[model samples]
Target: MTESLATTVRVEMVRGRARFIELRAGTFLSPRPLNVEGPFARLALVGRYATLLAGDDLRVEIDVGSGVRLELVEPSGTVAYDAQGGSASWSASVRVGVGAQLIWRAAPFVITAGADIRRHTRIELADGARALLSETIVLGRAYEDGGGPLRATMQVYSNTMPLLVEDLDLRNTAHRDLPGIIGRNRTLASVLLVGARPAKACGEHETLLAGAGALARALAPHAHEAQAAVDASWERWSELVEGRAV
Candidate 1:
């Protein structure tokens, strides 16, 4: 007789203009090959979620399973400068991206949340030339009022410096209801941004997100337009917070 094992895998990346995130459980990513065998059931899995804000300019891929395969591809943009006898001027605009993926499974249930951010800008001119961007998201059926006990998070990244990464593992839904984690909230969310946004803009963004109350309400009766709202929320949190990366 042999004892079988399960595995979980996660791969994430953040850079100049592209990002990719992926994860899968039931197969716990481990040194030993992940193989789970049960008398009545057997489980196997793999997948990924990627976002390319720059179409035709950036590409990324994630092949997830008991084994994880993560990749990112980005086509750089340009910055030009010119001189006109007495004065010189320069202007540039670059678009970046932020992405994430969460894999949830039951029977021992596994929950994972992944995310990434990438963007850049250049300007050689005026006194108050400015730009801004951000991302945020709250996941749950706040409207229909649904809740769950499942929780987990996995994220990874690398750049010129040491590299930023976050692996958040949440457990005990009842615990999350404590005084800190989520307080009395039943929503899960993340936000990212670029440049700077006015206080009014920030306030408005949050107000708009009030509609994500129900996962079903999040969905557009006409079509699945909730993605737009979800995306908006995620970007709002993109705002940089002073803290150590986890």
Candidate 2:
């Protein structure tokens, strides 16, 4: 007989995406209770291999303030929100999950993703919270021998919507064929915020981030903006996590 008890993974938003993500990937996390304080929300995801898709509901228990507990059943195809009142609402068609998979010859990727984003969260709140960050990294070519292939993708989502989606597939062949794609082959990371303050807010995101790069080489034209963007979001996220309404 296969030695099996119950395999499950548990995660909690001890601080949301601002400071850190508290994730417990294992079997014993289930049937457990969370009594912690400070914006605590327990996430219970089932399945031997965790992947957010249809039919998989991410069971969530959140308590923001007061003594009331909010229970949310986040189906892979849906996202739900509950207030201090017992009232609950859900998104129509969306898939949100946190998972890790091993890809060949590249660093293992941990993806917190939500597809069909429009289905979850109210339109106002979802759009208000999303940052939609992208990082396209072009490898080193300044040294003549540094230009090469690279692959990595780190993604995060909110309200069953994509907040940060970093996709990097840099190959020498693809690099040479495209212009304005990866001009100098420099690594680019960019952070986009939905609710940025003055000087950082721009109706058009790309233009704003790109224009900021014109003043420096690190953020110059190309895919490297991706990395810079991601980093900036983390800082901004940290600020948001620290109780600052974003």
Candidate 3:
């Protein structure tokens, strides 16, 4: 896809309130304004056209200025259809200014049989900035055996220091199905908090990273069930993000 095809959303603090400074529509996704609450401005991601087809490339860019709070939501889940021997990709890059906050309640992403996908996210947080993010990946639709290959990667940094970095390759069924790995699970859900420390861990899947962040991950037979596993951690961590003193 051309560089102009990338969607961009930018928000900044204006007169003690968060305001959208830029909104650019892309070939795949468009940013729509929602209501605002206090210092937070809400935005919904709307699909401009059908997506996840073979050879499709989707990109989203987000920027939040200092002292601004932004919340992003999706109307519905995303599904990747059969690629017919081809592949598709989705990537997002985010930057949060000093003392800013970002909360993204992303919908589940489904991979259907014969689909191949590559997903990635990179977040850059300034000092005292915080972010709460949730992601759910469904292997297949109802009553399906399994979905196609998927390679997922995530990187988060605070200033110039790395907070978290991970890469997962679910493309190989044999390796992915191993006991320590996914193992019979069709859904994987995760909640990640960065740039601040929570009081305590809430669940068995929750882990405090070396830096100032926490991650809660779950694998289950269904998408809804998988999300339930990290609900508590999400709540606590989001509260910390919302009430950040910075």
lDDT of each: 0.24, 0.29, 0.89
lDDT of 2 by residue, 137-205 (tens): 333433332233334344334444444444545434345436756564444444433323324443233
lDDT value, candidate 3, whole model: 0.89
Q: TM-scores, in order shown?
A: 0.27, 0.32, 0.95
> Residue by residue across 1-246, what tens digits does model 1's lDDT show?
112222233232323221223232321121212332221112233212122111111111222221211121112211111111111111112212222212211111111122121222221111111112221123233242222322232222211111112333333444655665655543333332222222433322243221111111122221124334446444333232111111
Candidate 2 lDDT (Cα, whole model)? 0.29
| Candidate number with greatest lDDT | 3
Residue 222 Cα positional deviation in candidate 2, in Å, after optimal superposition: 13
Worst lDDT 10-window in candidate 3:
1-10
lDDT of 1: 0.24
Candidate 2: which stretches are off by over 4 Å? 1-9, 13-37, 40-144, 151-168, 174-178, 192-237
